[model samples]
Target chain A: MDKVTNEMLMAFVDGELDPAMRKEVEAALRTDPDLRARAAVFEATRQPIASVFDPILNQPLSLPQEGLRDGTEQNRSAVYSPGNPHSRTPGIISWFSGLFQPPKTLSVTVAFCAVFLGGLGLGFLLKAGLVTIDTPEAGLVAFRDDGLVAAGSLDHTLEKYKSGSSFVKTVSDGRELAVKPILTFRDHEGRICREYEITYPATSRYAGLACRTEDGDWNVLIQSPIKSRPTNGKDTVVASGRDADTVDAVVERIIKGDALGSDQEALLMNKGWRGQD
Target chain B: MTEDIRERVIAFIPRLRRFAFSLTGDWDRMEELVQDTCERALTRHEQWKPGTSLESWMCRIAQNIWKDGLKSKKHRAQVSDDSLHFLTGVDGPREIEGRLTLKAVMAAISLLPPDQRIVIALVCIDERTYAETAEILDIPIGTVMSRLARARQALYAGLYDSDTSSACAKAEG
Candidate 1:
């Protein structure tokens, strides 16, 4: 046998080789370390490549309208403008937004309360310009100057809160927001970063990540809206949407080790994030 | 017949999306490509014969869209190489490490040349056979085999081999 080539190994890995050639490659693989190692490359790369895009399958299909007759250029832009929610097809947006609507069977007082809360939430969302594509940093109202600095209530919350702890802070508008720290970990740079979720009662929810800088200031790296599906009486965290996936990808990129345990987080918090890298 | 084509096109959305994601390497662009592919497939339904593989025809439209520069060059260039820096990082537990490895693999695939990338997408990701991929891309089976081999080797080198310095050095040697 004239030594097996990499292409032959790939064909064998893909099961594209004929049985006779496959038998030869298998025999070689059993006896040859270098060939075995080369064969491992195809086997290893195949699994992740096949499964990497599996998440896209479960997402709602965002196809164009059934009878759209316009030019491809015109319809493509109108269907998906990335950050712009309004430009999205109304049917898809309505399907997602409908999940947030209040049920209609509540008492008059409860309905009034729901209306009031919904209005306040809408006001906050509008004031923050979160609905528009122009404001990519819509949820991080506490951070200024390109999210390098965390100030106001968010700064205080990040400094003191432990994982799984929740705090409510009333903004100047008298609307209270619930903030909870989801987890803590040291990033590759050895800086302590926290993943937290903020909920506007029944209105909206966002997940954010921030890391402490050298000067003790928390820098907001990314914040994204999360969808919470109401199951039974409790709200369960469902899909985190595309922006949330970006946050997770960034976390995967920077995280150094396992998320800090509660005891470790407490020790770090007590020492003001000092004496550790 | 037109209704049948429309139904088949809709059914192939997930497969098309996976292929588009591999080629575009970005979610937003993937959606755009899928939409455009769907649009083109329906509008030109006459070109598609009744009994052939509709998925292959749709994939061809997608490849042409991507190759004809419907996707901006600048956006393709923006698939960042940042994941490459973390390839040699210390591993965490199995689940976390598995996820990080997958992310790095995706980033590496994004960097492959368009020809090899599509070959990998069609064969590896979309699970297309050599003959089927050759027919869809209008390339020879030998070319597909070579490209798949090279692409997988590049990915393995870029990802797994980075963690084992001796293996990497030996592979280079």
Candidate 2:
């Protein structure tokens, strides 16, 4: 074999050369003492240089001035909910949210009925299927698989909801919207709950509920969008905040807790949860 | 706007912070770098063109931000050559070679010429491939190989020279 070039040696060290080239390089290095020395030097040089810093992955993130100013707690809850209302992604979102101070306390009584909404989650190496988002500008409902669920997008399977006085809007076919009122009140365990239903458009859609905290941020409680308006017994129901059996159980939990009584509703209204749009 | 996209970016920040720290070697600065990079990635969503690797693109932005800000920090190097020598060399002292070998790596990187330093950070430490790195730096693929080789060599010399190799060895040990 002709003398192995330095490039070939380096490439071999890097595992960049194909099998035939690697075999040729290896055989030459074995026969020549000089080639073996050079290969060792190259390999030694390729070792990692230790850094001064230890793992800084969880160090406190520095909030930009704009992020601090714009991301008020109320605004965060008001706008950013990804996936659907019943989305399972809230845990991840909450994890991300805990990094910064909430802009305000929750005020669901003041929670406004209308505005733009969105959500999303992040991953270390993002794939095509996973959602991509920073802290959202709206109330977000996230799912375990890391997808965002939009608010108006879930208008089709409005049947599951039965709110007492809360406003509901669902796209019906192309031209119509099924509107209704909702009743959202805290149960005995202090978990606030909402019930409502809407008929959706032909397009796929999602839905969810948000409970505001005193800090002015909306803690996303439930995000469940309809995969299909279950035609009857034929549909399979995934267990979550939306499961028919669990819904009444949750409502009962909310009911027996006595937190959703008239006095708490007035308190929620004063805090901005009820008054919010 | 898709739910899928939102969640992915949110999940990415923690690891990205770690990578940025490895690149910049400063926790505060790394956080600032990551937040700005995320903001830029979101605002410039139109520029991303969709269907390409978002992590690489964000990583490229982070590399640029670190590079752009490096020139401004020239005045504040607190550690003396002796301290760095004691801190980074493979065998400066028995106490010096612990987890601090990681620090030695950062110190060596800081000492490198910017051209070599960046390639090392992006390709070697961050584990990005040459093709993705070339696209991030806007250099040719051949340049990635050349720069990476030189960076690796310079890193060995910078990190394991006689003054520091003893302490640096502790890191390897």
Candidate 3:
């Protein structure tokens, strides 16, 4: 047989060689120290390289909420149910809605139809400029000059929903948006801040952290468009690149201690966030 | 059909993330690459033909996006430093030792030329066969073998030959 090259050794190590070639290499390895050492390099580097990135697979998949956009209520419900273990937990969404009925202190009812119509009305008003948006970005039209006030269904959800609860709002244009509060933590200034993710169906996603002010309004402290694809549908967005980093940096900066537990969040909600201050 | 494709793309995310990490060897860059890959795969999904390997197709998109970004950016020098921090941040002696070794492997992998690096990521890390890797990267089987061999040699030298630590000494012995 001709001299076994490094390429051939590598192929042999990878189990790509036929049985005849494999036996030839095995025979050479048994006799030739130099050839064995060369093959050893290929063998040594294989498993570590394969296993080094295994940790990433176990980490949470940070996907944009793309596939959940175009579905019906039943489809959306099924996507989050326990049967679909891959989907993010639906417990968080249903728990808050179940635990706290519409805020009795507030005038608005908790009915889905009423909230939908209210959100539709507010969406039209925002579009008509009757309500000014201090920062008008896609998936973030709810902000007002007084701070980042949640309008319509978002307003109701923010006022009543606990951390991890998610609700969908359909606007006048028939676009369905999913809003979910991800974390609840107190900031260094003793204000209760909630980090949230808003997904604009077929368009973009926005992540923001808003603090509840003394007046009981959730003021947007920071909001960034974390992901946006090109309208042409060809070019790709960097997904959760710098924008997500910026939001994370802000969260790391102002956040005090850990995020509130589900029980802690529930207690704070029951208190109407009053006596804690 | 688009909905099915989208679900399949979502399912392929964990593998794509692993492939992305192998390519970039930095957490932040790996994330960016994965996201970019997902967006491209989801948006231009029609370009992906059925009956082919979706995992390989997505990986191809990730490599292209990473290469395009590389063209505009400077070569990374901070990956090793970040890996060091990651290594030390963990607790438990056994876990720490494992992570330290893994981080060293990753740092070494990061230093390979991008071509060799991608080949390693696909063939070695992702466990794709030579022919499959050739198909994914659109390279000949001969090219894949050569790159894989050279990359493995470089990685072995970087991990063992460059140091006289007990681990290296044990491996060599």
Candidate 4:
């Protein structure tokens, strides 16, 4: 017969062994002083470990305010927002169940970094009147200025471009900003929106959504920093970066339906950027 | 149904908080970690398969999120220092008493490395099966057993001397 190993004793102690093995171990332990001593040590250690931490199970904790949705309530109110604490933002996990409409164009430039969705430390691209220091909140999240120009550029690009054509525009500083339309779709609120990424190698890079207003002007709903890979270009620069959580929150909030298929996007473009227009 | 999930998630707060405390060993950071876990779980709740263990899924999310936080150099430094404080400097000299008190036991467990501590907490303290622990920590069951065995040995060495062991044997016998 093989000698009894410590692992077998542990398996016996932890009830991990099958019934035949357990019976064998029990019989072996009755005749073996060494195995019993080792088993006692294991039991002794296990008991104290439980006694030490089991008290924690009884300690009261401040309950979290919200819980996970089981996809039964797909259109439920958004309860989690990244930037604003008072307002509820959409649950990020809720996206996996086909609850939220996926964005048409997920920008390849912004590499996803892990960040807490609630306190998104935004790096804003400063343009004109949009730059302002945020009042310090309870958390240590820092908001930096470097984001609005990219946001505005994203808006303009969505308005001017057709389905297949690329958009290029000159800002006030004469820097050329190019926007490539990934796809266009109508949101849950019936707003016609286009998802695009603005790449200005010299100035900044941004990925955002541009929604058409009633008067046909484009408005940037959300924008975040683009992380350029080092191997792609030697001249790439990142002005500000958003974490994965913030990006997901933004997408969850604005998207209302599936991304437009190629044919659907082309048909919409032929009828003009807005089908009504 | 959403409300039921909300209640169930809320119920998990204590266990999550305790697990967080074990990882961080700081009450404030533990609470923050738990809060972050809840937020992440809610946001990504759609990804959770309906019939599987919710606790294990949430624990996996928490472990991954914490691992992500550890990627920052500053956070890694802080954790290193905290581990040293609890494991070596504070608890080493005082636990030589013949009896094993709760404080001594806790200090002994705290002396473990983070990975070992996590395995100990999941398997020994929380009474999770080895398979469940392996799933939660995203390690193999073999690794879990080895870490757990090492942790048990450390605890026994820390808490038991000849006098304590003889006394325990005497009382039990």
Q: Kindly list the per-residue Cα lDDT of model 4 for residues B130-161, writing each as its tens digit.
A: 99998888789888887777767666765675
> Candidate 4 lDDT, tens digit per residue, A1-277?
3777776777777888889998788777755667777876676666435533433433322111222223334333343332213223232223222222233311210111111111121121122221222111111122224222222334334543454455443222223445566567777777777766655644556666666666555555665656645535765555344334554456567777777777666445433344532
Candidate 2, which CAPRI tier?
incorrect
TM-score to native of every candidate shown: 0.49, 0.46, 0.49, 0.44
Predicted candidate 3 versus true structure: per-residue lDDT over A47-106, tens digit per residue: 545644444443432211222233234443443332123333332223212222334621
Summarize candidate 2's per-residue lDDT along B88-137 as a digit string, tens digits. Answer: 33333224121225454666666656667677766655556677888888
Clashing pairs in 1: none
Number of colliding residue pairs in model 2? 126
For candidate 1, lDDT tens digit of each residue in A1-277? 5889988988887788999998888777755667766776776676545644443443343323311222244553455322223333332222222222344422332333233223343343344442211112333345455555555345655776677766453222223455667889999888999988776643577778899987888888887787655556665555435344667788888999899999788667655565465
Lowest-sum lDDT 10-residue window in model 4 chain A = A108-117
What is candidate 4's DockQ? Answer: 0.10
Off by over 4 Å in 2: A1-7, A41-47, A50-54, A57-277, B71-100, B163-173
lDDT of 4 at B94: 35
- Model 4 - which docking category? incorrect
DockQ of each: 0.19, 0.09, 0.16, 0.10
Q: Using TM-score as the measure, what is the rank order of every candidate, best first?
A: 1, 3, 2, 4
Candidate number with the higher DockQ (1 or 4): 1
* Cα misplacement distance, residue B135 of candidate 2 (Å): 2.0
